[model samples]
Target: MTAWIILPVSLSTFSITGIWIVYAMAVMNHHVCPVENWVYNDSCSDDTAKHGYPKSCCTLNDVPLISKCGTYPPESCLFSLIGNLGAFMVVLICVLRYSQVLEQSHRSWVNTTALIAGCTNAAGLIIVGNFQVDYAKSLHYIGAGVAFPAGLLFVCLQCVLTYHIAATTLDLWMAHVRVTLSALALISLVFSGIFFIHDSFLLQHLAAVCEWIFVIDILIFYGTFAYEFGGISRDTIVTAIQHASSRACKSPGSSSTSTHLHCNPEGITMI
Candidate 1:
């Protein structure tokens, strides 16, 4: 069987790395402002002077300036593509793993809710990546609007689910850590949103910083899934093999004694 624990860890790592790599590429190409500049713009142009603050301040809007990193076209396509696709895959796998965990723990409601939130987040990421801020402002903002809150909610639900399972199925300390990270992610997202609504340059910069914090926290939160992936993968594989064997033994024309040896009284495979 494959070492499934590597799946989530790989996806999370790729998502985080993709974002930073895109940011770096944008900065190198002068498509976006350097981190030190603090200014947020599609081109990092000094056009924010009219707002009374130096061009060093970041821009405040419903969508983050990072989404604009790919506005420069062909060269930046990889940036957006990697970020969007990586994030989508990460969330998709995360949702599946969480659902399995919840199902095993007998928390069906939480599993459903978390799956919905994770799917929403994944969809939002697709929108955000496809619609560059400079190309389609409305769509970009809409995507950002959906992604931010939904992502936070996903983390929150997962945190609750983790807490519930910690006593019986998971490590207590890991659950606590996940809960704390989820809380911090939500708080940072809220502050980021609040600051984005203000006109002050400093507030906007702070908002950008908070947004980064939220993203980082989310990546870390997802990384926690690494602990259970292997067990889940093993169980799933074993279950499949057992089911297959039971079917083979019960096939038509098979001897009753043979079927009795392979099948259980409950009509279920005992793996």
Candidate 2:
């Protein structure tokens, strides 16, 4: 079997490719201009949809956000599919990461908090995917609001954890990489938000660019986990579960008589 390292790689690959595919579809259908033109054009008009096949077009006054790229037909279905599957992958990766960290380093509040933030980020992704920005503006914004900040927090926490538990030179180097990526992600996120709210078309375009940069940065950070995750195997998950079950069996409320049924002599639990 392949190492669990594939999980993070798959998540990053599919998500980045999928979003770009949606953007391509939008461009092909005349729903939005090519990203290069959209960002650099001084003037844009929403009239393409009238001359073309699409029902809507992203004009200069309305910069195409990533979410906006999938608001229309065809691409919308792909977008939702990517969002839901990506969210599932994110959750899985988060769980595996938490388990790995707990085993390598002693459990701490940082690890626990990272897990929570990751889950929140995943939930936000699901919402963003299912709710198209044009159709459900409020809900879409809510999801973005939750996902972006939570994602930043998750990466920052993971960087700190990497530095805290780093033992080898490779681990220390990984910490440095993560710290740099986290800083860039933070800067992109802040500018994306700040520029998005402005009235100027160029500023809005810049915001869209920043949003893409932020997302790409996050995906790259996730990809970095593949190196560490290369060590994870089926036994890793089994061991983590066994540890949890044994801890539960030893809780104060559990009786010795029930303990034998819940846990084996080797401390492995049947359940």
Candidate 3:
């Protein structure tokens, strides 16, 4: 029932579901243009036809032939809204839970840095979602730049923390799994970046796919927190219940109190 368990589960379920919903809405709405229709030209309107590239999601200032997947009416708004909210919730939970995790561990400065990086990544995600690429290209790109790199940094930091804790307190297998996920995320992110930068249409498509992979990997990694938090929460509840029961049993003049402590140590009459 603690927020630690609730938040991680919420984040994992909402983010994965939300993004796919947005993608489905966009595609079903026919907002995406075919890859064969993409082109580069002086005018945004003319690029799709002249560039001789496959039809894809239209960028800002694209010609009439290109589909504006991210800018079309309710779908666009829905995508941004879901993305912004999801990012905010996930990051907030992570930040709050991170302190507890650190407290359980060695509480090193590196973990603190990871928390900061996670916050930065969250901020970047908010910015990216709010500022659609078509609406504000420069701002969108800036947000994306901040988000991707910071996200990678956060992942790396978490992986290191997991390894450190596993060596001492946590399960070694869990630590190994986290490290493996982080590595996969890192690799996917790198390829996504490269494909996004390349001029080829096919490369751009590959970049999009890689980006999805990167996101999925990160989400899965975050989902693992549910297991961690669940264990902690169970222990906390058990401890609290035991402590409360002990207090109740030790209370003066309680009918159910154990005979072992019936006599008061202070020799004072009970009210």
Q: Write the number of the candidate with greater lDDT, choosing between 2 and 3.
A: 2
Stretches of model 1 off by over 4 angstroms after superposition:
38-64, 168-170, 234-271
Each candidate's lDDT (Cα)? 0.69, 0.84, 0.65
What does candidate 1's lDDT look like per residue over 127-187, in tens digits? 8888777778899889889888887888888777776666554477877888899889989
Order of candidate numbers by TM-score, starting with the best: 2, 1, 3
* Per-prediction TM-score: 0.74, 0.86, 0.71
Could you say which candidate leads in lDDT?
Answer: 2
Q: Model 2, range 162-256, lDDT digits (tens) per residue?
A: 99889899999999999999999999999999998887767888888999999989988988889789887665676568667767879998888
Which scores better on TM-score, 1 or 2? 2
lDDT of 3 at 256: 51
Best by TM-score: 2
Comparing 1 and 3 on TM-score, the stronger one: 1
Rate residue 63 of model 1 by lDDT.
25
